[model samples]
Target chain A: MLRINNLHVKIEGKQILNGLDLTVNAGEVHAIMGPNGSGKSTLSHVLAGREGYEVTDGQVLFNAENLLQLSPEQRAHKGVFLAMQYPVELPGVNNMTFIRESINAIRRARGQDEFNTLEFLQLIREKAAQLQLDEKLLKRNVNAGFSGGEKKRNEVLQMAMLEPQLAILDETDSGLDIDALRVIAQGVNSLRSAERSIILVTHYQRLLEYIQPDFVHVLVNGRIVRSGDKQLALTLEQKGYNWIIEEDAA
Target chain B: MKSPVQNAQLQTPQQRQQLQREWFQQLVVGAEVDAEYDPDWLLPLREKALQSISTLPLLNRKQEAWRYNRVDNIFQNSFDPLFDNDLEQKICIEDIGLPAIDSYRLVFINGRIDLSLSELSELPAGVILTGTAEALRTIPDQLMSSFDHLHQPGEQLFTALNTALFNDGVYLHVNQSVTLDRPVEIIYLNNNLTRSEQHVGSMIQTRNIIDLESGASATVIEHFISNNKHEKYFHNNFTDINLADDSRLRHYRIQDESRLAYHLSNVQITQHRRSRYFSTCLAFGGLWSKSAVRVEFQAQQAECDLLGLYTVGDQQLTDFHLDVQHRVPSCRSSEQFKGILYGRGRAVFDGRILVDRQAQHSDAALTNDNLLLVRDAEVNTKPQLEIYADDVKCSHGTTVGRLDPEQLFYMRSRGIAEHSARKMLCQGFATDIIESFELQQLRDYASEKIAHTLNSVESEMEHKNGH
Candidate 1:
């Protein structure tokens, strides 16, 4: 349940998202694939309410509310999750403690009971097991010395814990190894439900083979130039963004 | 504590020399050695100290060690001897909250050892834990011989004054080869309720010369606390540690004075062949606190671990000046000092590591990191490495910065308030030093104190804004 009409976004007074229109119904996984500078990441960040992305001329409607007006944390509390392309490394914040606090904060804001230490430990064990993550990583400082693959796994683990109503995965496959990519895709697949919608933004079609997005939209020059079913991803992989670029030019 | 001795007024060179002559005569009279206790072997040292005291002018800010420190106040206060009495003799050991240590316990109320509550019964034979005043009367030869061995009088105003007028102190002597597992706890309480001037001068001389006999290890914790929250207080103290061959010593100092108290202490340590010395200093409270540590690696294969943590708030000031000297070859020293400044508080750290000319293959390191939480809070950090040997690995680094904005934003974005985020980041900056403490109870207590102080400042600011 998300809708954007004529979403024209400008960052630093430079137009990024120009008259873009997109909608994703609940239970649908939408893949927005594009070349560099196509506003793919900008769309995800704008929806997630990151600062400095001035909404010059657009409205993002999520569950009949203006998502742009909410602060980043408020947006998070309202079930808007953004799995950043590069997760920030917080040196002293323990991974488990941070995840627990984040979940509890959102839950408290949403009028839910908070999890105690034992409950939190149990919850993290279950989630980590689901992601096939090492339990030892949960005790370390958040991504202090984590490898590239480990960081992506951590983000997916958080997404599972937060269980956002609408999830936006930005370039989640950018730095993942083949095995890590499979594990991460599996984690994301397990979290899919009829009540939750996920917007997968990527430049590679490798991750599409696993999570299997329902709709594939080719983004060119900050606009969705083509929309098709899952086979669109296969065609784009067989041929490349160059064909779409030439077709858009014609 | 009473005011320390003021120096002669600055004058012309001719006038200064004349003042020096007069001060020398006065110092000789003031330093009249006790009869029947003076050692012939220590005669040269006493004479040298007398001459140094007379010739060496009081420390001025011009000296690199005292560069950022306010020595003018010390120069304005004249030395006033403190008299010990039962008026302030009350001390609840439970309130002190010291970890249980083996061996006798001696409590110093305003610098005089409280022998009534001391447990001297468990001390090994020939081990002494008595007042210096009485020790001099009983064994004058031993006390005089070791006095000023590690420290010279008059070199530092406080140390010189201590030598001239130390009425009472703790004299701990571990018999040779005594493998004492228990550490002696010396609690110096500076409660300024005595109505008398508070000038605390106590020297701890450990001569156990524990020739660890090749593999013996012992840990000693020396605690200094001044909870007095009033004016008219001074703490001028010194500690001289002499470790024999193959011996190990762990020294810990906890100095938490009130906002109106002054803390000045000198720690001089000398290590023999293969002797290990470790120091952990935690100074969390004081209006004006300054400490100097001079460690000499007198023999080869010696190791020293120097760690310190100081947290200041309000207009409080804390200064730490340390010199890790590598006199012999193959010595190693690792130093780390972290400080947090809030309110209008200020902190200064001048750490110097000196590698002697012949002391090759020495590894020395010094690091000082400071975090400023408020605009008015200030930190002056200087890490100096004086290396005369080319083969030594000597590195010094100093960093003074505020909390990371990105980290702060991340924490706040998690719904943790801005104040909580700042406090957590500040605590994280100090955790490196706090984690070094082996005692979990002390570590937890220190962490809580630091966090509480940080939050207190934040709340006070919030309240002021609310008004």
Candidate 2:
């Protein structure tokens, strides 16, 4: 469902992602693990089509379409979703209104009928119940004063509503407590299907315990130095990224 | 009344002044002291007003209050003072298009009370609702004592101009302890019928006085509208409100004038002990408009809330100047004003809150927020707080910014179009102030008008961009 070929990206003349490559097929979950400054978040931003990043070389293809050619909103409409590391706080936009607009927008782009208010309310209630989210939070401004855990849950709620073909969770577990992590993992697990793919990007190996990945890639200095099965995640959790760097140097 | 035309020949400053003097002389010619209907006491007040306005020079940009506005250019076009005594022209209340509320409706055409168009039979006992001229004859003592106290003539150029030339206006007197069930509506309709051959602009000046006796409560809505969009006119309006002890007044003023018109209004309010005053102003139209509000708390525990929203586009200019004074202790005042400027439009907001030396425990807050859609649009906001008391809580904040780029991107990323995202943010910015209105109908009306303005401006800009 997603492919990155020698992705070389730079911000303000400082290269962040250099010669990085990854591939994920439908019905597969991949965990990209790295230490600080390993370009984990940079790869997510490039896939999400955020501006200010210079793509000096190579390309990203999503479902056989050249993702770099599309705008941010165009990428979104084409079934590409990015659960931001830090979800923005919109002061005046209501939570329910924002989510409804997002769902309807994507649906409209795909030539689908929009959901009425009643239909949306029912869908949101069911999804929110699955995630154990407070229904009252839907009436407040979008993450304006939400707690850290609530913000993460809200992002998961959005993912459930959007139902994108490829979902990139960037640091989704960075600020979550253990309970929140389990609930988020549960939400992600519920969306697993034969035609959907998810890319989990994090520094810790704890999230891999809740929703195990089919592939684990160790990234360092903007390059994937190791690719293995789920056992690699357990190995890195015991020894950290130093051994991986040593092995790459050898 | 014959329309006065401007001389086509080039004139010097002395010649212009001479023309102005001649026009003033013609206005008061036969009506100098005892203009047939003038009461014996009102004659001297009019004479004093005329004497004051005759010498008070037109405001130049040099003055602090008029610095940001082009006051001199508004007077360049010669205007004849409109005095329409044609009481025979019948007007249907349904045609006015206002919400049909069960209240006393006082309608004025060209600054004179339209007796045939007004309905006042349902007024409650002890509640006086009539034209100012009639109030002067029937409630002479009440009018005499409060008129001078509420309105200070010659304090400003337009106030004196309206005082010396105004023909008639609405007078609302709520007697002591009287609580009105329904709001009183005062509609000022400018219907300029001057022929093209005359080629003169009409000037409409009027005053509305509302006095709430001790413990009385009422709501008043002042609506100013124009029938002809192409008519060129100058409307100078003055509203004086006095809230006595324990009384409350919710006052709303809506200014929707012609696009070619100039509107200048002054609202002066005085609050006594334990009195409360709430004012909401929505300014949507006019080529050049300014509304100056001055409020004073004369006794302890008085409270006031001032909320305003103004939208201007396509070379329009709107200005708001609010001055609130806390004279006694334990008083509170809050002011929130928001503006949205599109095209090459410009706006100015000057809000000042003063706490007297003896006004301990005075709490005051003032905020002015403006949004400029296009690069050429400009706004000048100044929030000033002058507190002489040591134990007072006063804060003022002003913000001038374009729509948040991140917010826009967030909305756009959800597959919403860019233009729609901007419209949502703009509406959110303006609706915050419109929702402050206590009347639901007014809130809905103002919201619809703002949305219409935003839609037209957005489409026009998009068209200009050839999108």
Candidate 3:
């Protein structure tokens, strides 16, 4: 479903992702674990088509289409979702209003009919119930004054609402308490399906215990050094990235 | 039909003054104020105003007050000062869409009251609602105080012109201890475009008086709109609102005139002990327009809020000037104005808050926020705070910015197209002010208008920026 071929990207004349290569098939969950500054978030941002990232070399393909050429919104319409580590807070825009606009926009671009007020309320209520998000929080400004835990949960709720074909959860487990992490993992677990793919970019292996990945790739210096089953995550979590760096160096 | 001014680019101040006097003479000759709405007492004021028009300096970019607000177009255009007294031409409320509310409406068509279209039959006994001409004829003495409180022609050229050549408008007086349940609406429809007979542009001057006696409370809405979308005209209005002790007045104004028209409006409000005056101004039309609001707190424990939202696009120029005076102790005044400028559109916002020495414990603040979409679109926002009292809390701030890129990208990354995302943010910027409208219908109506105007503006702006 997704392929990144030697994607060498830079920002502000500084290289971030160097010769990175990864491919994910349908229904597969890939957990890319690495130490800090290993281009984990950079990969997510590149896939999402954020500006300021210079794609100096290589291209990203999704469903036989070059994704780098598309605008962020076009990529979104084509089922690319990036759950940022920090969701920008919109002070005046309500959470529910943003969700409704996002859903309808994606649907319209895909040549589907828009949802009216009543129909939208029903769908949002059903999805929001699965996430167990507080109804009152949905009425407030988007992520304004939200706690760290709540912000992450809101992203998961968006993932559920957008129902993207491929979602890049960039450090979704960062800064989340154990209980908040559990709720987010549950929400992600409920959305997993045979045709959907997810790339979990994290620094810890704790999230993998909640939603096990089909492949665990150890990313070192912007390249995938090792690809194995879920056991690779446990080994890295226990021993850390020093041995992996030494092996890559050798 | 021939352009009024042959050599409008006068060389010197003397030449400009001489040319202005000639134009003023043409307006005054046809005004015939003494024969219509003017009373015996107002004649001397008119004479003084006529004299002042000759001596008062013409507003130019050199003056401090007129630095950012352009009035050069006023001198270049010819305005037929004759009242649109073709009362025989019948029209409906829908013919000119404005004052979207329908409660005891006092409709004015072309600077005169169309009594047939005006409806106030159900007015309560304590409430007095009539046309300015009707009020002047029957209650001339009652109107004398309004003129006395107004700015003399010597102080401002346009105010003086309006005082000298004013024809008709709304006269609302709510008695003491009376709470008018229904809002009173004044619709100023400048509708000379349909009448092709009007080859030369028309000049309309209206003097509206709203007086609420002690303990009185009412909501008043003023809508200035034009039926024809494209035609040159001048509409100048002066609204005086007096709130007696403990009186409360909720004022909302919508100025959506012709795209080719010029408008100048001033709303002066005086609040007494413990009175509350809430005003919302939404102005987004006219080729060149300026809306000034001045509020003075006369007694202790009073409060006032002046909020406005404007969107200037294409060849439009929108300006708002606010002056709030806190003279008594324990009074509060706040002004928040937002502007969106696109294309070659321009906007000017000057907000001044004055806290006098006697106004201890007063809380005053002013904020002006603007969004300049295109490179050519311009905005000048200045917020001034003058505080003399030691214990007063006063602050003023302003921001002239484009859309926050991160905020835009956040919405765009969520599957919302760039156009929809831009429109949503711009509308959201206006939502805070639109929601301030006490009327729900007005909120809905203003939002629809804002969205409609803001839709194409962003894409047009993006296209412009690409170059």
Candidate 4:
């Protein structure tokens, strides 16, 4: 469903993602494991078309269309969703209102009828129930005073609502306890289908226990150097990234 | 009147003295004409105000209160005082943007009360609503007790001018232990300059007095509007409110004047023990406008909340100066002022809270926040807190910033366009203050007005870019 070839990215003259390439087919889950400063988050942001990131040399194809030429909003319209590692807090914007506007905007772009208030309320209630988020939280300002667990759950709730074809989960497992991780992983696993794909980026192999992946790739120095099945994550967790880095050097 | 060449012939010191004398003479003539028909008890007050205005000079940029304001630009054009005879055409309240309310309403054309447009019938017992002159003739003792006590002359140059030259205004008095079921709305429509040949550049000075006795409660809304968009006029307004012990008052001032108009208004409030005062101010239209609100705690355990929102664009200038004084023990005051400036619009906010030496256990806080949409738009905010009592707690903060780029990016990433996202953020910023209003109708009206202003400015910017 998505392909990246020799993706070269830089921020302020500093090379971050150097000659990175990855490909994912329909209905397959890919888990990207990397150490600190390995450009895992940078790759997710580059795919989402965030500003201040210069794509020096690369081509990203989503469903046979060039994704780099589209704006961030355009990418969203084309079913590209990035669950940010650190969700931004927007004061004075109601959480439910924002979500409704976003859903309607995407629907309008896709030539579908938008949901009214009643319809939206019903849809959000069901989605929110799946993530175990309170209805009161939706009435409050968007993440203004939310807790860490609540923020992560809200991100998962957004993912469930958007129902994108390609979802990039960047460090969604970080800062979450075992219980929260289980709930969030369950939320992600619910979206798994024959026509949808997810790329999970994490520094640990703990999240793969709940949501199994078809492929595991180790990203070192901005490029994926190792690719294997689910057993690869368990091996790396038992050993370490240093062994992989040494092997890559040899 | 002396010619420019003749005035130049005099020495510098003589010219200064001569100008002061001319200003004093003009003020005395206006005051004397107004005092001719006023009650006997008001003549001395008018004379005192005339003497004060004679000695006190017009405010200049040198004063701390006028630091960011160019008062001289407002005074460059000469203005004659509005008289009772200037009321020619009658105005309908509905035509001037006042919503229909099942309550008492008093309409003023220029500075005189338009009796034909007022609805003062079916008032509750012990409630008095009439023109100031009529109140002086009827309830002279009750009206005289609080007329010039809270708002005195010589406190400010404009207050002195208003006291000396104001012809007519509303005088409302609610008796002890009475609670009003509906608000009392006073509409001041500035349509005096339509007779350009006789009253061009005229000044409409008005003074409103509101007295709520002990345990009495009411809501008062003072709305100022203008009909002439191109006529250059001046509106100087003064409001005095006295909340007795255990009483409460909700006050709102809506100022939407002509683009060529100059508006200067002052509200003086004195709250007694255990009383509460809440005020919301919305300022939208005016070339140059200033609203000064001063609240004083007269006894212990009084509380007040002051909230305001002002939106200006296209070379308009708006200023708000709030002074809240905590005099006795256990009094509390809080103020929040927000402004949205677009194009070359300029806004100034100066909020000060004073905890006096005897005001132990006083709690006060002041905050001023501004949003500038364009590079050329300007905002100056100064939040001052003076605490003399060692046991008091006071805080102040000020912020001037644009919209959060991160929030913008987050909204846009949801497929909402950039322009729609910006409008949502800006509206949210302004609505945060407008939501403080207690009345639902007023809140809806204010939100609609703010949205209209934002849409018009956005369209203007788009048109400019298209050209």
lDDT of 1 by residue, B261-286 (tens): 67777777778788888888998876
* Per-candidate local distance difference test: 0.75, 0.83, 0.84, 0.83
Best candidate according to DockQ: 3
Supply DockQ values for each candidate.
0.31, 0.51, 0.77, 0.63
Per-model clash counts, in order, read 8, 0, 0, 0
**Candidate 1, lDDT over the whole model:** 0.75
Interface RMSD of 4: 1.0
- Encode model 2's per-residue lDDT on A6-25: one tens digit a residue: 98999999998989999999
Sorting all predicted structures by lDDT, with the top scorer first, yields 3, 4, 2, 1
TM-score of chain B of each: 0.84, 0.91, 0.93, 0.91
Q: Which candidate wins on lDDT?
A: 3
TM-score of structure candidate 2: 0.91
Return the top candidate by TM-score.
3
Candidate 4 runs further than 4 Å off: B1-36, B84-90, B147-155, B192-200, B461-467
User: Where in model 2 is the C-alpha error above 4 Å?
Assistant: A243-250, B1-35, B85-103, B149-155, B192-199
Candidate 3 residues lying further than 4 Å off, grouped into runs, are B1-18, B87-89, B150-155, B193-199, B458-467
DockQ, candidate 4, vs. native dimer: 0.63
Pairs that clash in candidate 3: none
